[model samples]
Target: MWEMAPPKGSRLFQTLGRRPVLRAGYAVVIGVLVLSVVEAYRIQVSLSGQHEEIYRRYVDEEEHINTLRRNLWQAGNFVRDFFIRSTPEQAQTLRSQLQTLQAEDADVLQHLAQMSPPSPVPPGVVKSLREFWAVLDPVPITMLHASNEEQYDFIQREIVPRRGELYAAMLDLSDADKQRLRDYDRQFAESNGRAAERLLAMLGLGVLLSLVVAAFSLRHAETLEQQADRHYAEVEEAKRELQQLSGRLLEIEEEGRRRLSRELHDEIGQTLALLQIQISNALAALQGQPSGPREQLERARSLAERTVQTIRNISVLLRPALLDDLGLVPALQFQLEDFQRRSGIACEFVEESVADYLPDPVKTCIYRVVQEALHNCEKHSGSSNVRVTVRQRPGSLEAEVADNGCGFQLNAKGMPDQSRGLGLLGIRERVALAGGSLEIDSSPGRGTRIALRLPLEAQPQPAPRVAAEVPA
Candidate 1:
């Protein structure tokens, strides 16, 4: 059956949604947006500065042009008055004034050219300036040589009319320049305003987006923290349950062992003892009988001894009494000796330092690890020589069990036998629990060496009080 997918707004939708490559996207987007806004703002500032400079230049140019126009008008009036009544000296002075006005006009034109030129001046202004310069160029010489009336008539008729046309053209050009500048100023102002508004809007959006992202991140963090707390609680509960189960299992196993031990010691042990005593009585009774009967009695006595030894072996197999009575070293020694005697294997046991510093569990774990390694050697490798070394250093205790055996392949799935592999796994776990480490090295046709290192620091527990004896 075809199943419908969850809707986009559903919680399941988000959980099943494609993972966002959001952070990188956000960084790229924000960076580009910020750069663009900054660039726009920078351009706006630069253009605004340019606008102000252009406006200032235009103002200065217009003022100079106006001053030139006024000077030219005064020169024309001075020539008119001098020609009408004054001497040739006054007329020559007026001509000098006209020369000064022309020079001033040239200076103003040069200043305007250096500044930002407005759109091209009208054709009429150019024509007027050319014609006015043509008329005035000969006027200086004419004023110097001609009669005052002739000079006055020349200035009033030709120079005055042409100067008026030049002045009007100059004013028109200045107004056109001012109009063009005003248009540029308005365009620049509008562009700057629009850019600033956009930059501000983008900044506001960026801040809002940042706030949203932060809030979402904070909420996610809180959710994660709550999840962590819940997981911790669950783990603690599981641990408590595991501890209870382990304790219960250990108690049951110990109880069963005690019952079995008691049954062996009380019932089977007594029966064996009674059988030995009966065999002795039979041997004694047969002492005066035939030699054949005496030999039978001997056979019976041997059988009883064998049976007793077998029972003892069974009891030892169930639990080693030496482990409880004499502690770890003695128990280990007994086991090694028994292994050598039974297997006829060459074995060496070396102890570097004898320190009663290890806890029982650690000792047991190490002993078992050695036992498993030796068993593997005997069963699988048929190794003849085994060496067990124990050393107690300042900070740690170390043990190694090595055998000159044909080692088997060690794969990731672990040792060949699953149950047997547990021995190594258990050894590792036990060492780790004791804050230690274990290493195993082996290869086919080489040998197997199991090394274990355990911290010397004992598990923290209340110290036992020593008994003080009274003077007797």
Candidate 2:
């Protein structure tokens, strides 16, 4: 508030000091505001004290009354049980209970003398408790010799009447508590009406000061908000740029794999086939001569065939040609089959007749997502069975890979552990590049399910299209 005032040497402050009319007006206004605040504080303190005192007294009275009622009811229960038992053995416990209850009841009535404005319960209620206990203290011994008919007669005559009187006293105290609350409410309303009237007049002057203050505050706030918005937009642009770069990096990596797969199949693969043919020819030509040379040639041919198969496996793992040659379904089937063979886990693939006109990027994203999901299941999930399902939606394609395995806990970042995070991150980047979404569901022993959804163009898209990238 002091900061809002003009400095001593400012032009406005100097002008006000020189002008008598302005100086006088400002002084009067300041003095009036100070007086109004002092008056409001005084009234507020008075109302608070009144509410506090009434509340304290009411609570103390109710606490003392409730304690009395409970003790009295309990003492009556002890005496009734004395009359209930047919054998004298059970009566011993009842005698001890009544003695204990009498001590507690005396302590309850003692609090009434401590109350500031005496308890709401009449003093007669306390006297009634003492007299009722005086009558019950000896009744346990008398009950041992009495018949069941005589016990019922004593309970009807003595126990029920005194317990009812104590209950009635409590009901009166409850009524007093309600009445005290009603009085406080009425007084609060009357005081509040007067305070509101006084505050309304003071608030009229305060509003004028607030308007001047707000003009300065709003201008300052607007300047800060403009700076914030500019910084926010800059940060958002940086993230978007980073995402696009990541997507491009994934695309480059995939292109490299495709090139490498093709080279292995075309160059090294053909060379190996030719080498096998030469070894087989040598074996056939030397068949009638030495058995040692022919056997060595036959072994060389066998080694060549196995090496060729190993290279093919490596090429497929790097980037399956079926993804580009056929479509998504065939590539996934082959991947699942390879997983089942490599790891002894069972694999099931279910597919709907998906449109073949889908873009290559979409197909690649779905295939890689399934491939990563299966790999995680094999490496981490001790799963017996794994299932993969791909179906087409109206404007999208959905693929799900699930396993019944000992799953995993997602960490604080909603990711599987750090190692799995690295694998999922690549799939997320690829899916983002193809306008798709990936969802992973996994927890302790329940198993994991990875669901992938990709948007589709209405018509067949012959040329693959790259999507706007987003972060995982």
Candidate 3:
């Protein structure tokens, strides 16, 4: 026989990768359903056990109460027969047996009280017991002092009748107790049955809800899986486009830098040099001439030297030569030293295994970030001391720059002109490009601390060498 095929466009046709979140949600819902089922089963078992206990107690109490009533009736019959006997000795023997029977009845009543039955014995039962006790107590004393047949006749006529009445009342009391026990048992059964029914209903509802939730979760998972596939495809495409755009942007930036560097070097550099040469020539020509001419040439030479120096500073600010020639640490050291000297701020530098661990691009990013931070500190913070630290750990690199300066409120927004507060933004972007995070902590009148953490690529380990056999 041929195997049946699944319907078209069914869930089975979809791949597992299509909906991870929905699958997770469905798993959670199924777990909750299983727990509910287990809990319901437990409650059902517990109620069943309770029902058995209540049933047993009801039966036992009913039997005990009935037996007590029958015994009391028998004691009444014995007393009546003794009173009707012609011999005093026979009466004495019956009275002793009757006393024993009465003690047994009292014990039973006490036991009943101890049981603390759910329902109390009826008021009629209590009244009957009191009457029986009154009759019995008086008869034991009166029988001992009784003289002859007259006393015996008195016992038969008066005490016997009262004893019969007391016995009947005790029987009625026992019957009332039995009725109460039966009623209590019925109520208990009804209450237990109702509780079980409610529990079952709750369990059924819980199961139904679970099933509904499971179904919804399954359907939702399928939809989410489809959405995830679309999102993944979009993300991959975006990533590729972003990579291409970044490369193009880097190329454009490099070209622009080269053009600017060339212009500064060829135009401004040559002009300044020419101006210096011309001034020197004029100075040489004015030797031993008028004081004014000599002074003018000297002043011109001085101005030309200052112009040359200013141009060099601007070029370095645009792009540092050391950064291009050397590595990041060396470049940062040079920049920090220059800042310290110019600003007359005491700045210390510290490093830990960072020189060999960081990639060149990451190093450049971190260096630039630190450079901007320091510049901001010098311009804004009235700080006297600064400390820069660089360290490397197992998975990342870290750098911090702290300043003992009059810090400003860091939570404040940018200045009115957007151009006035791009320093921190630039630092943040540089760190982000290097796959790092930046945090700034500062308070008014306190110092400012800037921290950077960058993720590092895992270094490949060397292959193990095979051991060579030694000559034996």
Candidate 4:
């Protein structure tokens, strides 16, 4: 049920304890996660700022270049109209429009120059616009003084060629800026990909470290659990052995008591009786004679009789003969009467159909249970009344001894406390050995009840020794 542990002098890890390893693992994982998040956020912010700036620059460049194209085209159309009609009003209008367009182009170029990096306008695009405007500056004035044919010749040679160049330049500038924006987006995408790869690598490293720490910790925990299980098994084995030894000791004790009771009853009782008889004979022999020592003989005989009675009582207390001769019920009745007589506590004994053929062990167990319970009542229960009941069913026998006393509390397991549990434990052991069950119930102020049940089936018993009866 367990994995083999490392050999002695071998550690689960080469360096650092499990706790430190686990802490380091956690720290690494968290640090990696935090850094990854920060990097992602930084990347996002960079992309947003860069995208906004790029888009703004692209839009502005397109707008200015488009404006340049529009103005240049309009100027070309005005020059065509002047060549066709040769009108002073048209020429003046064309000059004023040209100046306004040039001024607008200049302002746009200045604004583009002031924009942030990656110059939106190519270097030569601005220069070409300025030179084209310079060449067209005198075209309107020339148209007013020149003949129609000459004007047409000048318009075609100067205005038409410069206008085409400037328009083409504007188109080229738009295309260039679009290319720059595409390049910037590609570069940003590559940077984001590289950052993601690095973050993933860090996370993978952290996960691997965490798994190592977890494995170490789990192995250590399993080791401790195995050790605990071994210890528990040893304790349980010791307890079982102790219980068997205790049961053996109790049987030996009972046998000793029985033997001693017999010896005292047979030997000492005979001796005292002989002494009493001798005194009676002596007194009879001295009858009718004064100063015959008859009074002393009577006193001696009285003392001898009392001594015999005392020895008989002691014998009964050690091992009651009624238990062997009259069966379990009579023995229990006598015990209860004796208890009441001695303790001055009221005791009631109730019995129903208890058989004469009960197994000796069961009888002993039941009697001992009652004996122990009554002892507790006298010593600890502080009670005024006690009750004992024994009943026989088809297959079992049940008994109870209860007291209306200031009962004591039970332990967490609802068993007697250790300090007071010796007698109760002994009773339980006996009952268990007899294949029976016992229940103890009590509370602080209510009362105490000890109930027992024994199976009627014959249980295995040790062989009994043959013994002689006590002399009457």
Candidate 5:
């Protein structure tokens, strides 16, 4: 079966499309340059042919005109000799030359009829040739009849003057033809010059286009290199951030261990020791005087209850049960109350609930951030009042903490001085881990405010609420 071939134009286009852009551009430019060269050469050849033809024609006409002038001059000389000599022998010789002159004149006329005149032959010159022939027609006939004196007078007076006039006309025509030939030569020179100029322009344009293409390619490569460098720099920065995060986490862990050890050793261990002494005293009292042991027993029981409460408070600080059970609102309220009692800083909570259900991670993140913010304000701000607000927007939650306290300048890293601590850094990292953002605003002698936003989409919704507010 004969399959239909694809169209030639489509096939050519497809072949060009598959080539590299630079290669294709070069091909197109080279093709155009080649075409320009060929056209210039063709035009030059054509112009040269035309100029040569004009020059050849002018040469032929000039030569023929010179021959005609020579014949006319020779015929005038022969007649002059015949008229002046007045001898039979001289007369016979003159007659023979005259006959030869007649034959030459006939040949000149025949040549003129056969050949085209040169360009720029003046109309006056053509009329002069006709008059010269008319004047010559009577010359030999008059010579045969006239005596020597009469013939001499006629040759000198009429034939010589007529020949002079004809010669002058032919010379003028020849000069005109020469000038016209020079014009054609000049025109050919100008055309050649123009062709050279056009060829140079085409080559220059092609080179300029190539430079432009090369410049664009170089610029594009530079841009790609810059992008690659930027990407590598970003990767290095991320690695540095991970390292810093790891170090900070280790520091936080160590601090927690020290705090727990102190709590266990000083508070829990002392309370247990004191309870053991109280129990021992109550047992002794019961053994010795049962009647008076009730008061001692009651005091020991109260001390034991206080120790239990202390442990509970520490556990709540670690991870509040209210956060898991009652949700973010109640947990925040409980934390604020505790913060007020411990720091002597009056604290308030405000909520704008956009959605009722809050994810556990989001709730925990917010609660921890708030706790840290309050702690920082208590420790660094020296403030007596603190306000915390949590607002719910579509798909996200925003929390802001502001304190009426003496604020200090933060370092370039946005961390307070080492004497103050790394509490803000901890909060920032925590917020980041929760896929949120944190902003701190503080100035010297002014109050500090920290705002954070956490995305709620990652949280699993368990309930919903419109709004909630807590008073200081």
Candidate 6:
């Protein structure tokens, strides 16, 4: 006997059940597709509601502004009509219109107050409107009872000026609202555009993933690995280019500092030095003369000396020639001495037996880092005691600048802060370019310590100096 055949639906289910992986995959794909459709509908509805609400608010605000304009226009007209009318009936009619205008003005103010919460209307505009209304509300009746000369003076002094002010305020409010509405349009469009892009990307990724799983999972995985490797290589290449660009920028900056320092030292420093010497010579010539001339000479000499000292300090800050002429240690010592003298903040510099021949870049970086750190300490850290230490190891150099002053939170994310400034960031970049790492330790009311560790192997050899030929 032949067995009864199963139903067509049951047979299909049995076939699907035979391949559990395929059944699961189909279910997942269907579920994702349904979810995508539902999400799209929901997003569209949401965007539509937001768009309508924005437009509705925009329309309401625009109407309120138009009403304000109309109110000012009618007010001016009713004021003139009350003055122009001769008969009692005409005056009474104009008076009624003025009263109606005043009522509408109150309504407009109420509307403005309500609109202000949702619109961009400024409170100043509302205040100006109220002020104008206070001047305008009694003008019609007052003009009706006034003589011709009195009405003319009132129009010139109050009505004309106040009306102009109200018009100006309304114009400003209208323009501001229009700008805000345009911005809203742009923001909404951009938001929806981003959402659409993300949705499309997800749908496309899902479809591709489904197709890949159905066909070749292993091949897809291999392809993904290849793509990831390619991306990583591209990223690494970009990073290298960025690093090279940063290094070049740093080199150009140092060269600029060197040029500026030379100019300040050679030009301005010489000028002030010459002035001091001249003042001294003049004083010698005027010695044993009148007391007045001698006192004037002394003041001139004192000013010249102060000017010379200022020029010297500026030259050092711009770029210290000692770093290039002598070494890093001398430059740092000079800086600490200057800082101590100027700020009255005690400073100490400690050093180990550093190698005599250090790369110019390394020397510059080290000097600049210490200088900026000290500057920060002087400006921000109200600490009385600051210490700078440098040590040379077998293969590396380490330096730390510590302050006993008030410290700040060490921000790792590098958010911009004007109070903290870019000194720390600049130091960090300089150290990184030198194949070094920088560490900052600080807390409020405690102290700050900045440690720099640079690799010795990365330091390039200094270029050989050529002796100038002596004249025969």
The model with the greatest TM-score is 4
User: Per-residue CA lDDT of candidate 3, range 59-117, in tens?
Assistant: 66666666666666676666556555535686667667767777876776676677854
Instruction: For residues 1-472, write the lDDT of model 2, one tens digit per residue.
Output: 3657655434543565434534454565676678688878987898888888878877777776777788777877776666666456667787788778877767766776666665555778777877788878878677789888888888888878988987897888789787988888798889888887887778777667555445545644675699899999999999889888887887888899999999998899889999999998888788689788888888899999999998898899888888888777778878988888989898887776576556777887888888888888888889999988887777899999899999888877557777657888777777777878888888999998888899987865434332221111
User: Between prediction 1 and prediction 4, which has the larger TM-score?
Assistant: 4
The residue ranges of model 2 lying beyond 4 angstroms of the native Cα positions read 1-213, 411-414, 417-419, 461-472
- Single out the weakest 10-residue window by summed lDDT for candidate 5: 10-19
TM-score (all chains, Cα) for each model: 0.56, 0.54, 0.44, 0.77, 0.46, 0.49
lDDT of 1 by residue, 1-472 (tens): 9989755434532664322523643675587577767877687778878888878877776787777678667766766666565566765676787677778767766666565444355557656766676676555455555786677578678886788777877778688778878888888888778877777777777777677556555655676799999999999999877766764664466456556765776688779889889989988877778899888778887887888777777766555556556655566677788888888888887776545446655565566677777776777777888888876666776889898888766777444456456667656655565567888888889988889887766544333323221110
lDDT of 5: 0.74
| Rank order (by TM-score, best first) | 4, 1, 2, 6, 5, 3
Cα lDDT tens digits, model 6, 366-394, are: 88899899888988899998888887776
**Model 4 C-alpha lDDT per residue in residues 421-471, reported as the tens digit of each score:** 888877888888777988889999899999999998843432332322211
The C-alpha stretches of model 6 lying farther than 4 A from their native spots are 1-212, 216-232, 287-299, 411-421, 458-472
- Regions of model 5 farther than 4 Å from truth: 1-198, 201-205, 208-317, 352-358, 382-384, 391-396, 406-429, 437-446, 457-472
Tell me which residue pairs clash in candidate 5: 356-463, 356-464, 356-465, 357-463
Q: What is the C-alpha RMSD of each candidate to the true structure, in Å?
A: 10.3, 26.5, 14.3, 6.2, 13.0, 37.9
Candidate 1 ranges with C-alpha deviation above 4 Å: 1-160, 229-262, 279-308, 352-363, 380-382, 390-398, 406-420, 432-446, 453-472
The Cα local distance difference test for each model comes to 0.69, 0.78, 0.69, 0.80, 0.74, 0.78
Worst 10 residues of 1 by lDDT: 463-472
lDDT for 252 in candidate 5 is 77
